[model samples]
Target chain A: RKLESGDAAEARDNFAGFKLIKVLNENTRNKCIFVHGSFEGSDDDAVVLMEKTPFDKQSISAMLTSTTDLKQVMQNDIYGVYTSSPPPDLNGINTTIIYPATDRHIMKYSAQQIYLINETAEEYQEITLPFIESQPFSLQWVYNILDKKAESDRIIFEDEDTDTGFILLPDMKWDEKLTENLYIIGICHKRGIRSLRDLGREHLPLLNNIAKKGKEAICTKYGVKENQLRVYLHYQPSYYHLHVHFTHVNFDAPGMNIGKAHLLLDVMENIEMQSDYYPKKTFTFTAKEKDPLYLKYKAAGKM
Target chain B: RKLESGDAAEARDNFAGFKLIKVLNENTRNKCIFVHGSFEGSDDDAVVLMEKTPFDKQSISAMLTSTTDLKQVMQNDIYGVYTSSPPPDLNGINTTIIYPATDRHIMKYSAQQIYLINETAEEYQEITLPFIESQPFSLQWVYNILDKKAESDRIIFEDEDTDTGFILLPDMKWDEKLTENLYIIGICHKRGIRSLRDLGREHLPLLNNIAKKGKEAICTKYGVKENQLRVYLHYQPSYYHLHVHFTHVNFDAPGMNIGKAHLLLDVMENIEMQSDYYPKKTFTFTAKEKDPLYLKYKAAGKM
Candidate 1:
């Protein structure tokens, strides 16, 4: 009640009602755990509550390998479901999946890649959209995607902004540059917040820091001039998690596409002009036929 | 003559009578200096020579910042163009651009991608062929792309069959992967060799070693199982360089397209079965309206 209207921190601390579900796959020897909690909504019958702690692959690994790992694994909890939900798929290939006793919580953003979209718009209506509509929302798998480097070491540097701890990861490709240049991955500690629309003015400092101080670090550490680095975010990212991509001007990385890439500074300025800049405007992103998300969008006639 | 016929190493050792140029910009303070030299050719009036070493940005920074920078700064090396010619556009952006005044020889290749391409046969012509046709045989630039980290520090592990050095770079995108698995950028030290098409039986050791030993190293380093790592090459790469991509089997990256990515092991086997496996076949890759190379291909009627 109080948490819903405005208090994000209070909402995070109150994780008493949710059930924690763990997903295990021995083939991967990886465990993906997701939060299962729900609350009644004004319009929708039941909406799942999402945690706002950004995933730490290292912590998850430790949680899976050891029984006595620390209980307080999350940095800060503050996530809530933002949109319409996808149904859970019962016919998952892995038999080790466990479901919470209450089957009404949690959801997934059916992710898709634009590059692999080989189907016509018509195909979207008939085939692709149906598959997405029918497919299960696999939140557990998405949770298990981060590994140790993300949590322990891949961090180039971090900053304190808007009462949150932000992480900086150098993309492996950027590290391989022939010259000392900037290619970085910026991650926020908040979890369950899927895309740019989730961000508010509170995130401004973190975004600006990376564009300025973070860029300066690249020059000192990699010896690349400050001007060479550009920091930006992807609208329809490779995944749903909120992360910023930083790269040297010269290296033509996969997501650096003009249509796809959005400069971080521009994002900040745009938000300043309009509090709900992202949500107010619709931007195009690439989604493939096989992606379950594609099917949902197609069925909605949004594709 | 000695440089092309049976003496790639010896030719590298003999450096005499060539002036090196450096490009610097003060406003942005970004300096991008390319090596420039040329000579007369056998058939065409003059053929320019290109050097084989890739640029080392770190080394250049060291040179620019300090006097006692221990690294060797490459200067005064002689290079001659090596094959058929592309008429140097007199209307180049930089007037200082000289046509092979020292044209001993020069050459080119066309490559493309399928994602941007929609029409079946039209794709084969417009987007695909043009990409292949106009790609600059910038052996000089490619040679300088590999830095020391790629050759030495970046190597996950080494094997015996390959006498040549192998470099493993982490993909810029892979840093975000949750698990500490193998998302590698594999580089070979053979300068002037553009892509897999340029590889031969003599390079077998390096290829096999990486697939076998490199895979093991990834498992040992990242705790990923052997089967989890996938090694591959991008046809008509973002750039013309002989580098292979390695990633976790679960990750669905941009170029993982069935029509684009070529498995390194499969490529090696294909080469063994036939010497010119890549050269004998035509494949597609992606290029945009903005790519200068696309313009060249369109003008040549292949696009």
Candidate 2:
């Protein structure tokens, strides 16, 4: 089927112009229809015209004015309707046809194009976050959600008091806060140890052995397929600390899925619970305990 | 001193010759040294002769000689040192010379140039292996060291008593003959109740938790700083199993000396001792436990 310039030109000349054009194939029986619309001169006079057509004997007929008109032709029982264009507005007949409306086709194609672009962008974001966080090395960091939430409040308490407020939580309450599917993996830089220089030189063999054994146990327990997991080590200079992170969301995987982020969080949570690699203690955050401290700020009108 | 190559009338005879020379310094050290070399020959020959003199000011004086004695000097240092020309007995003088012979300055420079070219190539092989192995999707097959060593003998035994011999000692021992420092992280693909897939899926969380706790425990136990410890994972695909490896090798950290391959083995051994996630079992591999049916083959040197 051909989309001739003449048909377009003819539509441009008339008002409620070219209603519908149908294309049909007689042999294999394929069909398509085109409808035109425009808002050239005044917006109110602009009209949209549609055509429902079928291809027969390798040619398409003039536009079918309505669904009923198209259905009437179907009584002959030929091929199916191949394509249809939107109907024209009967009310507007004086506006000059600016262009035959291909907005529907363009809109459909554009939507699909946009979806593909957005999908790739989202995947890129998911993959990049873990990598950036673990930068220079790819180590996962575990932060307690509750602790982060509390810290966000911007209360300046003494170190000991801060520990009491957050770290020294009751064990039962801590367990209660944990969900069934959630797990925690802790990253801690313990105080009072020599630098990495001393440890790697003197104790690398033993340290390496621990990491190896830990990895095997985790993999065996998780039911992850081979080559499906990635682990990175990142050194955070701010805390003068180094930590390692094990990740399941491999950026190199075929398609990045946001679901993998949730999976990584679950893995981190699990790691935190099973190992004593990080210290866990109970802490309380009572308003009464902190109110006296808040009153000092209130007196300064800073609360 | 400038290279005066226009024309020279030496000893009242018109002779085409050029003086190759250099000036040491402009003010404090205004010393001109005559570069004695043959100029009656082609540019290539001139270059060869000029190159024989060390460019260093400290050694240039020691290399200078009279231009008239070029043939004799060339005969002494250049002839027969590197090439055989005009027969070996021509005037009993050598025609070829080793360029940097006895010149420490030239020798050191040549050695440095050679080292720079070779160093990068050598490092490529050493550095790239770990990076490739660390890639998330890299596939590595794990074979029991013992299994590989006894492959030939096992094949022969299988031919004799196919079923009984194979089932009796299905698991191979670690190959001790291979001198490489290597260890196996045993990954079994169990089916039915606890399949390999199930184990892998469950293993990640378990291992993550173990790592979290283990890191703290190790820090406390060893009295090492928390930042000194690190964990990494690599998936071995040959086993068609999923496993996480926790390794403490910090390539960028100061003072890490273990080889990559050996470090991986050390990790496996550590996992065996430290990890609580795996279901531990003891198995014997004594010679006496060998199937009785294979005794005949053992005697025949087939097992």
Candidate 3:
């Protein structure tokens, strides 16, 4: 919202009137620049954010395959820093940029942490289950989608089978570019099942149907093959509703990292072999310091 | 080795004669800048690489808490880009640099893929197991270490309990700096077990011992608590020799991502519950395009 408002203002009047005050924070890990600033005639303080968006596959491929005029800014043997600008479309705000920089360049530029949480089945029941039940979150939107009261046009595929069906839709974060970073989600039709911990052998049919149909839909509509997809479920999911994520395997997606992602195939097999595998297995996930689950773990001395 | 050779040369000559020719590749994913060039007086072809290093915790904390002069290079409402350099030590080769640059800035400036391989138990037996068996790789180096004929001085901790014994050492990639990125490896003294696929309930004692003692050694020596440590093993490891990685949770270490890393605790639990769990279970791992495993998968039409 802040960015949109900023965009509107900048569109009307080029940032000639904007003035900088001081640096608020620099999140180098996420490549976000935030600063305290204000308009020339305004007394109200404003916060400005400049974030680096992820590169799509097409742009990178073009660069690697095509010839570009490269200007080396500095050189130290095999180590050199250079600045280059692609045609306007490929370049963002910073026309002159230096990259393929080291981890040190990014981290030293300021900072960054995510903690891995190992939650036993008993702990899940005692701590996480209770926390989810007690926490107030609105799932009305999910219900609306399931009931075809909202986002019906956005649905990529849907099987209305009451016992074994789900609605597949593009995740809000997806730009629908059909690139390697493509992402979509399949939200199950059946309610009451809340996250991976709630699944069992009885839910295998539903899981299998979703996995099969979801891949087919993507392949048919987006031209992405099944092999190029990463089908997974998140343990300690952000929302209570059971949903499956279908992403391009090439996408370095956040939250899809280890300690969080459980492959759908593995889950299906685990359940197929053992009825209560999901409920009984110890799932290791990540919890940030600000997470309530982290606080709960701290309270239980589990950390 | 190239980096070390450059360091040695620069230590004496101060990179004064270095000259740039052109950029070869810009790997934004790894933050490495590679180029083609030669010395000031020579026509000999040369290659140079500039990489941004990972930041240490102390340096970032000091920056966030300290006062720094503000200089704005450009501003556009909620977006602005500025360049500043930290004191010499905190800064690397680049004296002046921009912070919180965006993904667009990084990716558009260059380009990155890892593929997720879903190997069923049958596929593992038919393909991966045989491929690994046929690959000619030398474990003589590992043998030399276990025999106390190599890297003896670098051993951080060792337990000679025949069945559960292991030698712990700082990972070569670790700089021996006691920070959140601290990394160490525990290589089991017992031979024959090559990877996670070979583990069963019989090896629980060895795993548990490594998990426990490895934590104690780090806590005692580095003052890092067990909670701060992430102990895991790499699936489809760079090497077949079984070893456990001990890393501080704060470090965004490579190969620890979803498809590659398996928590030591989970592996132990899975094996404890079902002796042949790993042997029968499907595993999801990553493989690059050039990997032999990928080629094998291709031959089998698995991909």
Among all windows of 10 consecutive residues in model 3 chain B, the one with the lowest summed lDDT is B93-102
Mind giving the per-residue lDDT tens digits that candidate 1 earns over A215-256? 666667777754355567886565556777767655445665
Candidate 1 lDDT over residue span B88-147, tens digit each: 110001111123223212112111221122123344355544565565444442343354
Q: Which docking category, incorrect, acceptable, medium or high, applies to candidate 2?
A: incorrect
List per-prediction Cα lDDT, in the order shown. Answer: 0.42, 0.23, 0.66
In model 1 chain A, which range of ten residues has the least summed lDDT?
Answer: A76-85
Candidate 3 achieves a global lDDT of: 0.66
User: Which candidate leads in DockQ?
Assistant: 3
Off by over 4 Å in 2: A1-231, A234-267, A271-303, B1-177, B183-197, B200-303
The alpha-carbon deviation from the true structure for residue B8 of candidate 1, after best TM-score superposition, in angstroms, is 32
lDDT of 2 by residue, B1-303 (tens): 222333221221111242232111111011111111223333311211111111222321221212101111011110110111111111110011111112332222221100001112223234322433444632222223223343333321111221111111112332423212111122222212121112232344344443445445444544443333333232111233333222221212211211111122223333433443222211101112133322332454433
Second chain TM-score, each model: 0.50, 0.19, 0.73
- Identify the leading candidate in terms of TM-score: 3
Of the true contacts between chains A and B, what fraction does model 2 have? 0.00
Query: What tens digits encode model 2's per-residue C-alpha lDDT throughout A45-105?
Result: 1112111111111111111123202111111111111112212221111111223223322
